[model samples]
Target: MKTAVVLLPGLNRDRDMIAALTKISGTPPVTIWQTETEIADDIDLVVVPGGFSYGDYLRCGAIAARMPVLRALKEKAERGTRVIGVCNGFQILVEAGLLPGALMRNASLKFVCREVKLEVANASTSFTSGYTQGQIIRCPVAHHDGNYVADETTLKSIEDKGQVVFRYAEGTNPNGSMNDIAGIVNEAGNVLGMMPHPENLIEAAHGGDDGRALFAAALEVAA
Candidate 1:
């Protein structure tokens, strides 16, 4: 009942994610570098942290998504592993084809770094289970390519299946994401991707503890 956080060369938040999980899940999470080809057998959750992977080359997460570790991650995800991707990690998941849609340059054409109000669109998924449906929470976002876009048909399909996990609050939509979508989960409900940094809010000293529940909910870490 352990959990693991996969580390990309440029991923810098592994420790923070570990601490978050330890706080709520009551189990210390280990960091598995990208060089590693497989997750530890005892891992119950796999977290992909946010950072400038491959220095944001041609695309935010394009290079990192092709790393050997991602292929292993994809296999585990297919087997129903709980996967959480934040910011650049989210970009990688999309690039890896584990999730849908692409994160383009912010609609403002600027890097946004501020606390944003988000609505919990669906709380049934492992990542959002701690939140009540429609709950509003504030979390900080920092990125240049947080804008989310996809074909209308795909958007409608996801919505129909209740895959949307979070949405920017009305009037607080920092990016021009379609319908203000802020985060989403795959149909399996085991993979979640979002631009906001939940790892940053697991402690009140950092401003809010709204993110603690996400890790607690996703990691059934008893070891």
Candidate 2:
């Protein structure tokens, strides 16, 4: 599958993402810099990899959201392109307005880095179809602001629509997110945003391959 990863200034996980995707899909992913005004033609999926984009200034992803590449990202998403945003990438999606809610500082106000247990809330989305509903997946999360919060009404609507795709397991909430939500999908299911680093779990080098299924799912969808 032909996949593209947008690389912004300060992007640190582009190589990690490319390595993961190359292993899972047997194809090297292209890296598109944020300054590029156009995404490559025939790209099957687009990933906004994790990093302190724009040095996390003015909020984690605020500045990067307005970059030239994001304009193309929005257009591609609108055209039903598969998009996945991880960690700071998730922050960028929210700031870009492609996804809702904002990622805020951990409720306890500390940076967190650890393996987290997450339950698959809904396995029907293109990005998560590899897991069963309620299955536990171990993914690493590293960030100072991984807490996810939304107004009650929006949260309720997300639940009502089955858009809440992943949640920290009971009693294992690492960031104090509302309802322990770790990831969510859009109504169309073509776009996904999550705080966990699926790329980190993609190979035996990382001690596990639980997240390989996520990229597998993306490849299947793209095919």
Candidate 3:
């Protein structure tokens, strides 16, 4: 499968995402700059990696969401292409209106960098199909604004539709997110946004490969 990584200033995790995709798919993903207005239709997956884009000015991912690339990304998503946004990328997706809800500052009001347990709340989505329902996996998170929030109606809608894909498990909630949501997919199930950094824990060298199945499933490759 062909993949592309969106690049924006201050996004430090692009390289990690690139490396993971290369290792998993056996090919380097195309790099899409912030100004690029179009994404090739051949690209099967497009990932917006985690980091403080625009230095988190005016809110996480606020500025990056307005980039020309995001417009094209929205178009791609409308056409049913798969998209994953991690951490700040998750913030950007919400800001850009590609996904629902908002990511607020961590309830602790301090940066958090640690491993958290995530339960596969909805394993039927494209991104979580490799895992089984109710499975718990370890994933690392590094961010200051990982809190996920949504209005009551919106929250209920997503939950009712099984869009909530990952949730903090075993009292591992680090951000006080509503319903302990750690990740979610769009109504169409083609777009996903999450606060965890799965790219960081996708290899044995990183302790274990619990996160590899996600990328493999998204990339249509063997886990």
Candidate 4:
């Protein structure tokens, strides 16, 4: 995929994201700085990697969400370009209004950094096509404000539309997210927001390749 990984001032995972995208696309992904007002026209996928953007000041993703690049991202997402936000990126998505709901302080009030099981709640989207519905995959989660919360009406609507892409598996609600939602897609399915770090689990050295399917599916769409 022709991808761009956003780099925010406080983001710490740009290298990891860049490495993963390079391995998947066979080329280094473009890096878009927070100050950039536009994303490359040729980019097919935009990834927002996990990190403490803006040092989690004010709110986890508040400052970063207002960065210039997100305006471009919102435009691209509205135009049907695919975007995926992992971890803090997910928080940014919510704060930027690209995705629904908000991420709150973990119910436990503790930082959670561990591998958690996730189930493919919906596999019809491009990002999840490599997995079957109800399939289980293990991905790592490392964030303090990863608790996903939304009004009951919105939650029901998303569920009814199959926008809940991934859910924490049995006995695996590590952050006490509502309905155990680990990830979700926008109404159009071109945007995804998830708290898990799939990039961390994509290589053989990472002990498993369960997360490879996600990038493979996205790359296929871009190709």
Candidate 5:
């Protein structure tokens, strides 16, 4: 599977995502800079990794969402290409209107960096197919504005459609997100946005490989 990693100002996790994709898919992904206006048709997956893009000015991912690359990304997603946005990337997705809801400041009003338990709320999506329903896995999160919120109607709609893919488990809701949502997929199921940094925990050297299955499944490769 061919993959591409988006590079934006202040996005420090691009290298980690690139390494993880190369290790899992056995092919290095092309790097797409913020100014690029098009993504190759052959790219199977495009990932927007985590970090404080634009130094979190205006809001997390607010400026990055307006970049030309994001317009290209939205086009790719509309054509059914797979897309994953992690942490600040998640905020960008929502800001760009590729996904629903908004990511607010952490309820604690401080930065949080720790491992959290995640339950596979909907394992049928492309991103979560490698895991079973109700499975719990450990993933690390590092951010200051990971809180997710949506209007009541939108929340109910996503829940009713099984769009909520990952939820904080065992009282691990670090950000006080509504319904403990940690990750979600778009209505078409081709786009995913999450606050966790799966790339950081995808190897044995990182303590375990619980997050490897997600990348493997998205790339259609063995975990």
Candidate 6:
């Protein structure tokens, strides 16, 4: 599959994401700089990795959302190009109006960095096809603004539509997100936004392979 990873200023996880994509996809992913106004054609998936973008000056991902790359991303998403955003990338997706809800400060007012169990809430989408519904997978989450907040009605709508792809399992909600929402997909299922870093857990060296299914599933969909 042809994949592209968008890179923005202040993004510290680009190398990690690049390594993950290379190991999983068997090919180096194209790196799209934030200043670029267009995404490459023939791209099957676009990945927005986690990190403090633009120094998180205003709000995490607030400035990165306005970068030129997102315009191309939005257009590609509308055309059914699969998009996955992790952590701060999730914040950027919400800020760019590609997804619903907002991420607020952690209820504890602290930066949480640790492994958390996530339940596959919806396994039929492109992003979760490799896992069974309700299956728990361990992944690490590191962020302060990972608290997902949305109106009850909106939450209900996404839930009813099966757009809620992943949820914190049991007591694994490290960010105090509303409804324990750890990941969600767009109405069309081509876009996903999640707080956990699956790319950080794809190898045994990272502790477990629970997160491999995510990349494998997306690759299958793109194939």
Report, for every candidate in turn, its global Cα lDDT versus the true structure: 0.86, 0.89, 0.96, 0.91, 0.96, 0.91
Q: TM-scores of the models, in the given order?
A: 0.95, 0.96, 0.99, 0.97, 0.99, 0.97
Instruction: Write the number of the candidate with greater lDDT, choosing between 2 and 4.
Output: 4
The list of candidate 5 runs beyond 4 A from truth reads: none
Cand. 6 Cα-lDDT: 0.91
Clash pairs, candidate 6, are none
lDDT of 2 at 141: 91
For 62-150, candidate 4 gives per-residue lDDT tens digits of 99999899999999899999999999999999999999999999999999989899999999999999999999999998999988999
**Root-mean-square deviation (CA) per prediction:** 1.9, 1.6, 0.5, 1.4, 0.5, 1.5
Instruction: Please report how far candidate 6 places residue 43 from its true position, in Å.
Output: 0.6
lDDT by residue for model 3 (1-223), tens: 9999999999999999999999999999999999999999899999999999999999999999999999999999999999999999999999999999999999999899999999999999999999999999999999899899999999999999999999999999999899999999999999999999899888889998988999999988899
The count of residue-pair clashes in candidate 1 stands at 0
Candidate 5's TM-score reads: 0.99
Q: What lDDT does candidate 6 reach at residue 60?
A: 87
lDDT tens string, model 1, 1-223?
5788888887776777778777777767887778778876677888888888999899999999999899999999999988999999899999998998889999999989898999999998878878899999988898888898888888998999999999999578887888898899998999999999888987769877887777767764321
Compared with the true structure, what per-residue lDDT tens digits does model 5 show for residues 31-118? 9999999999999999999988999999999999999999999999999999999999999999999999999999999899999999
Error of 1 at 42 (Å): 1.8
How many clashing residue pairs appear in each of the predictions shown?
0, 0, 0, 0, 0, 0
